[model samples]
Target: MSAVQTQPGGGETRYRIAVDTGGTFTDVVVGSSTGDMAVGKALTTYDRVFTGFEGAVRRAAQSVGWDGDEVLRNADVIVYGTTHATNAVLTGRVAKTALLVTDGFADTLLLREGGRRDAFDSKAAYPPPYIPRQLTFEITERLSAEGEVLTPLDEEQVRSVLRTFPDHGIEAIAVACLWSIINDVHESRIAELIEEVLPGVPYTLSNDANPTIREYRRASAASIDASLKPLMADHLGKLRGDLLQFGFDGDLLVVTSEGAVLDVVDVLDRPVLLLNSGPSMAPLVGAAAAPERETVVVCDMGGTTYDVSLVEKGVVRHTREAWLGEPFVGHLTGLSSVAVTSIGAGGGSIAWIDAGGLLRVGPQSARSTPGPAAYGLGGEEPTVTDACVVLGYLDAQGFEGGFTLDHDAAVKAIETRIAKPLGMDVLVAAQAILDVSGHQMATATRQAALEHGVDPRGALIVAGGGAGAMVAAIIGNILEADTVLIPATAGVLAAYGAHRAPIATEFLSPLHNDTRNFDSASAASAVKELGKKAKFFAARFETVNPDAQFSYFVDARYPGQAWDLRVYLDGAPDATGDAARQIEDAFHAEHDRRNGTHDPASRVEIITWGVRVEIPRHELLSDEVTVTGESVVHRHDPIVFGGESHVTPRYRGVTLSPGQHIAGPAIIDQPTTTIVIPPEWDADLDDRSNIYLNRKEA
Candidate 1:
């Protein structure tokens, strides 16, 4: 794969551009070695994200006194991380897709492995299937679990189904069959037939897409990939064409769920990798920013949800058998930093009185359209943002650079919609809403830390976003984590993550077998093969340096156990056995930590193998060394909240020098976000200008 590179000349300087398209805003950050950083934010265009993205890019370039087209012409890499895929799934705006599965498995997508939609709630209903049963067609083909052919594929029946797809107005086709992971000949043939008949229509096959064990999961994963293919392809194509028109000749990369970047063209074939791309970038950026930290907890509170990820030993945790639609696709893959969980709790989450007259915060969101009631965007209902406004925690007059917030509407909405039904005063109701939302976030943080076998007390929580400051203290108290750090660019942290993200790719293959009897030489050969694949992908971004490193892992399971454990290896032959032992020990430690005991006598087996190749970007100066600065005491202003007023002093994020410390009961304001340090907490500025908050006693 050849890469397009641009050299600085003609009054141009080399630049790296990162564009993050969020629910409410699109942020563009341009970084150059000239010790200059330009940041731009614009209202996101939901109907066409590229319009906002390009606008932000141009604005960012203009801020630095450079033409956007000239900057694009001199840029080395342009990385994009968007919320399109996630929004599509959440809003149910996907294409009309049909699933072609093995006979007798038409209900596989609907069954969802017999797991309830909400595992904790007994009365919760299952989420509706993305593809309806009427669109799920069955084909006559059978293959044994061991890759043995049981019955020949019914080619005539497949052709007949293909003929009806066009008549049914199907946009995409997913071909999945039993045991296709081991033998995908039938599925491939089906895909070929569909393509021949449908021509331009997109088609996906299970074995080619995931190639992991478990029939239903593989099928569902492939179905999701196929379903999103047309949409993703169209979006990427438009973005690429638009950038090219804007004079960007550099290679275009998109962030993946694994915290690495892949070429936009490659992403079209594996759109599933982009499922959690936007939310996953923050942890990666945080980890890179603080490489020395062995363990850190990242809490990214966006408009719609709060995503928490745990980073241990400078790497994000991954899952081997994550549920796509729930049958269990055995593909070991990279996921978001907080692999344990994410919850629907954020600034724009809706707050309303339930049928039982109990106040409930979202699962439902105001999103970008009407937004929160405080946004003054025709939102008549009270929301979390409205609660913040009514409580006076937010400065309604200065919201979004004096974009104008309707405080009266916010209060009135809360009074009639939430306060009246709950039989409480508006101020008290607002406080209750804030407390509940904070409690929900705190509980989620505790659960994630505990489930990951991590001690919450030992982890440093890094909080970012507009809502993070409001909830950080509560979450920190509940998790028992003594230190919490908030970045200066908290609101645009994801965008920064996109800026600092590396251009890399991952390759995986299953190797289910007994580890004790496994051929280490064959495993090494497989690793080499995957490395070649990764190198092939990485070539599109930069020349592969001989010093480029490769990380390997083997997914193992105890014999007779359904779940597997991932064990990282350093790519040495003599250490293979020791690696296996270390993996077993880690598994025992994890199991003991989770279940209070471990069966040491259980035999372990290796299920899959994977390799990730990373190509780092140009290094920037570290924000570690302390700089001398004077501590200026600013006068306090009264902030009315919870039916009372408190004097809160404000500081600027950019003006805070390293080592400058401040006591709590203060507000630190930045253009992107505001951090409220509650009483009993103290904050210290770190090398990177990140504010670390700790309890006074601690």
Candidate 2:
């Protein structure tokens, strides 16, 4: 990683810090430019985000023999990945926002693409829009599809409508006039009026936010971007101020939904990009770990939810339909992001009996506040983490974050809440809780792979997060995967991934052209314009990283298709006959792989032109890890597996050297997490300290 600030001389070397804040814990990773680092974790303090952050950083610094505040002051840059913006949107805790669209489009949000999850189930209620209909005001203006003004801007009417916004306690505004992608004058003028009327009130123009062909999606993007302004602005401002108060003065970068870093100021303006930012980084690690693998499955298990993503053929897939809540009924983000499927089963997922007397793991969690009962934090519910503790998989002394696990509390919680009710043994009940959650993880991994037209069997599974290794081999066993690879930094992989993430941004231009009769000049000009924006953005982002890489993409589909597939071009196209064919071929191949079929003879309709600029990432240097002695089991404990108790040997993972292997019912506990080796598997440590668990021969 590059330095963001000048390094002060005298024994203080340039260092980079990456912090990932999840629902339960905050993980901090401090590394040198060569990527050797230490991970420290702590319970998340939601009330003060920096409190837990400082605690985690201090532990990491202490491990490296440095004072906490001194490390902060001497750091080069800190890349942070947080879930604050995502949580706020999902809980409706964001700023109050008003949506202003063109006349006759007041029902755009109310109708919400008019789709339902189950078409046969008419009893399901329609979900609420991002901005309530009552707050959606229609501006009396119109523009044709070709950028011609069908009706001139009603400036007085706009001013009158906005003047009353203050009374409604609106904190931000989103202006999404129809055809704004073609001509932005109407939306641009509204932005100016907003600045004049409400000087500090944040406003977003659809053209500047997401230049897409779909009016509804563009409007949705604008609505979300506007809604996040006040909340994210204050939240990010406080974070910066906290850093300054700690006497640390360096650049601060934040991860995006696209699995890259952005300037803090840029994130404040486009906070919508912060959604799913942490989960997106898991695929980055997977892709880099086994880039040549045809299909790589990455599962990041946190306290509240587990995210599953796939890296197919060395590329991390991105999707545009990232929903905030339910799939068909929830608000869409309308921006490009890494495709991640999340299941509500993790370390802290509460296990309960359903109405039918069936065991269910979770759609609800204990989060970090009271955490799992194993933490002795006053939580009475039996959670997945409690199961781990009750079964003796988690070691009290080896646990990270300087916390001790309570075996008695875990047993009591399960015995009262689950075992007694089910009339089962305490250990069996705990094992059942893990069985259910493991089923969910396996199901999600299978679905994620199958949905992408890839077979789950014979794939390489890369597990991450604090709780991921606990079930990595279990998922592989269920799916018949060939190998499960656990990186050395698996416990804090998301935070460590920040050290590898590139500084990147994307620009889009709406160009509705077809392959049959392509408008070469028009398409070329749009691509050229996108390139200009990329360069301008890079110029501003250069202070953080100077090197850059550019990639071109287009949204294209068969002529009769309702939706398009985003395809990347090998290089920026000149839009000649050959260039058109290249795009058409690329789209066809991707569409064929994703949809299982494509119409080669049909004309491909290209809707949007895009260019992504990113700082080229430097490959991490893998160091060989060797210990003075062979891997040794320090203790033995009764670990429950397959609903039965087995005395498993526990080994300290960090003390193991390369070429050392452990077989069968065994536990390898590291400072950050634990890995359980199943009865049929063997674990081997590689030179880079990555553990590979492989099943025995049939």
Candidate 3:
């Protein structure tokens, strides 16, 4: 049941809601068109998704002193962000799909681009392909690199093979013909045949799914897209029906891996785009909160993992190499997505003693069902949260949902599971657990920074998530960063991020051109055609965001390079020799910036041209901060930090004023999360109501 508060409203209030369902919590943020926002969080209900979703929504409405029933009836738009597709792909719970490839390419998925995570570790286990060999069918077709059909497609053979799909229990089909990007006739014909032979079965075509130059990535994208069609179609359909049943009559948009929102109808056609849906929203918030022309490392510490991403000049970084699990050992999504590095070091990460009497923190999470031992939810294992309680960093009465933590249970779990095993004090063992996890979290943040060509020491730190503020200062200290920005809505930052993401989509077409032998007429034609498509794409969002904008980019590389780099063009290139030279120069600059080296004098090979169309969100107001200067202390709690116990002054979040200063050895207990100010760090609230943590004087 939703935690509803029966308050009378005018019954005409408009609402915009964003719901992000994570592994541990389902966060809901309700925003009015005027830019007022409120957040609510509840433990994720794996059994009934709507239970947690409605509960969070109700609580958020209550926080704003409004009626939830009225809010639901009048919601204008509801954006939903989910990790369902990501989890399904990683856990091998996707639909049973069949892959149909060109003749003599049955081992394409098996070989997996011929790369390993650790080239020196030959003993590592080899991962199986997405579709089994038995389910892979080879069609008699051939297309050369120049769009010429070397061998005509055997329609009879394709029809004969497709007729047997039912026997193999194939729920969906993926057709990836070799050189389909150069010539799509054969793949298009197969799509027609699939419709004729297996009427109701869903299918994906490489030419339609991803028209890239890479053979493996195109096929991988088609296969993954096809695998998700059946599962997501049913899931989304059910969700829409359930929403209608719950009295919601609004536009339903789902978050995409590309850090934008797509209408549910559009997502139903390309569900694979939802692979990194939930975490992608975090960078949107981080970028918006950060200052322009500056670099910031965004760290979102959730219940199960700590996620890190880099933002430069207010642009969230995007990558094409998103893996399902274990980096190179796992399958690739073969799509451009917001880049994030995640480590298993969150509040729910279990702490235990290894066989050698060494203390180790997770990698392993207790999840939301059992949660932490301190939650009093029948969890017996010691977790990072239990350790936090043992260290007095968390208050027993300050948790979400008006629930109190089990202090005795936290102490018992740590002592019985860790302290007794190592013959050490319970508090000491708890501190060790935190130290290990903090080191891992700090290392990941630094690695993400270095990978994105930003120095950790130079970039500002923006920490979020329910567990993020609890350890933000600790991470900042380890990196020795000057300051950390903790947004007042840090706990539900991703949900807030979903509001900032606009309706956007990308379109790409392939062309082979060289700087010396440039095809200006063909390049102009491709851009013109893509521009039309982008215009049509923008038309769909006219009702919500009419003033859409477009950007153009090119994929080019040094001659004979294995991979190409993307460079956004300031304007569309003309049919002149100078334009070709300019494109070459831009490619060189981008290559150097991303890869740290570029051969400016080398010949350039241009592969793909693309256009991005977006309807940017409306800007109305800044953060709705109403300062009272009435900072109230919850209590003076004795918290352990830096090998010493100190009675820290705990302040309430809502009662704090702008520019209010709180020194070290204090706690700022917000409604959703608690921030532990270590003895060496001092926190001050800015005019935007953001807490800026800086190091104390020497």
Candidate 4:
């Protein structure tokens, strides 16, 4: 790919485009130097996500009195982040992939961690293997943990597997040897043989993907990557091709799970990085966009899940380990935000009663299909969205500007499915469902905070999503957070995050030496080499900016420890006595923070060093706008729940300007979502159009 030349400033117009593909809708946001903004949303086409994205982009451009082609021509950068890869894996829509492992590891995927899938749940069943056992071929290869050859690799066995690929008719291949991270010779040879036999078939190696220890997680990670490769490649290719055809000359960047952007070209081999990209970027960008605060938590509630992440010191904290047991086959090598947890808490999560006469909200969601019963789309189940409608939390006539909603049907569904079963009124049932869901979300938020050793009292909750706004105040109350900031575009914060992200690339390499007597100079040199790789990747976005800079860090751990910790260095170490001590201090501090203590006497080891290259984006203005309208409270109606009914009033969020405040026992309605301000809590709109909710003093 050729790098587009940077255009000189004065008299030149620069445009940027960001597209976020969610489970229900494809949101498009376009910004230009002319100070014009265009936003559009279209129902997602799961079968063809690119079609929906392009449609939304065209519509957004048209709304701003510009043609899609013209908009593309003026755009200097285009950033896209989607949940397609994640959705594919979760729904089992990925391509059939074949796995090649060491002779005794054919059942590795099935025998994950002694067949114990969930440590917390005694009866939890193991998830079906991504590839069946029959397709998991084994080859004779032996390499010790230290990269020494314990047994000579059976080249004949690998050749046999390659020859049988045609018979298996595998769409993709994943090779994960026991100790590939230490020595990938056998895996590399197998890949070469496969390429010779199956010329065009895509193959992924465990070491090449993650290169971290742990055979099972590596295999799982690699398997996910190979399974989703074809699907992600097709969608990304179409998106790039369409943009180019539309006259776009800018580099296209995709968000990664670490809240950084990666070139579209690199996504083919590292598609696993795209998982959780949507939820990850929003919190990072939101924190950066907000004023420098001490502690902040971002709650992004969408159609299916409510994702919460913590941020401090203008950076979102990353998890050193993968959460969901190697969803892909590879050595895990990524910086993920720590404590980034999500629950089945969202607007469309289905609510129903179980066999034991108990009310349950979800792990199962209605998604966008029939959506909520209030959507007037033939859905009979009452969801959180439907509960909002029946409880007078949502405006029946003003929903989506009266686009389409069967409020009456929603009420009926709640009455028949939830209320009648428990001998309660419809309003009561809806309120119970809403309250239970809120409690679940609040518990999750508290748990995440506690797990990270963070005190909620000092945390500022940043809320987004249509559903996030409605529950922000309540969550703040539960967590004892004094402020909850809901930005103007709360419903589409993810899309906004994509728009604000800088073009970025991260390069990583393992550091296998012992830290006590290790060569600090050699390690510093290795880090500098990785920095150069990152710089080269960032140069591709020269059209956006020519003088883009980069940042660096290293993943380190105490010797003999299983997990490593990340430490940011001032610069590459010089391998001198002073540099070694500085590196050791950094690791000590990080270790102390994570484990609540540090062992200065123990030897430290550097596992991997990484460098992130990026071009910083223009900071956004945070000035507050004046409110021009009065806070109008609509009449309250009875909402039944927990075998009782109570009246609940609704208020308009857009109408309430800065300095305006509303007391609880009310609902705040916005186009994208509704906020349920329970009794005993109060909400205030900030100067920046953010809604701040606080608990009422006793």
Misplaced by over 4 Å in model 4 are 1-14, 54-74, 111-129, 143-153, 241-250, 289-291, 325-339, 520-525, 547-549, 619-671, 675-679
lDDT of 2: 0.85
**Number of clashing residue pairs, candidate 1:** 3
Better of 1 and 2 by TM-score: 2
lDDT of 1 by residue, 1-698 (tens): 11322334433457778888877667777776454667676667787777878777776766557677666777777889987876676566777899998999887766565446455676766556657889999899999877798989999998888889878999988887988767778888887788777888888888767666655567767777888898998899888887787777887889877776777877898887787677777887568656688788888887778888778878776554444323321122223222635677888888877777777888677876777777777888777778877765566654542267788988988898888877888888888887778788888877777777777788878898657766677678767778888876676777788777766665666656554566666566666677788767566546623345577766667777766666666563233456556556666776675458877877567666677777776654233433335554344666544346678787755567877788877777655566767776789987677788888894
- TM per model? 0.88, 0.96, 0.96, 0.88
The TM-score obtained by model 3 is 0.96
What is the TM-score (0 to 1) of candidate 4? Answer: 0.88
Which residue runs does candidate 3 get wrong by more than 4 Å?
A: 1-11, 118-125, 576-578, 620-622
lDDT of 4 by residue, 10-107 (tens): 56456778887776667777877655566666656776666777777776766546676666777877778788877677677887789999888887
- What is the C-alpha lDDT profile of model 2 across 586-620, one tens digit per residue? 99898888888888888899999999999855544
Off by over 4 Å in 1: 1-11, 58-74, 116-130, 289-294, 320-340, 390-392, 395-402, 420-426, 478-480, 519-525, 544-546, 572-602, 620-635, 640-644
Instruction: Count backbone clashes in candidate 4.
Output: 31
Candidate 4 worst ten-residue window by lDDT:
325-334
**Each prediction's Cα lDDT score?**
0.72, 0.85, 0.85, 0.73
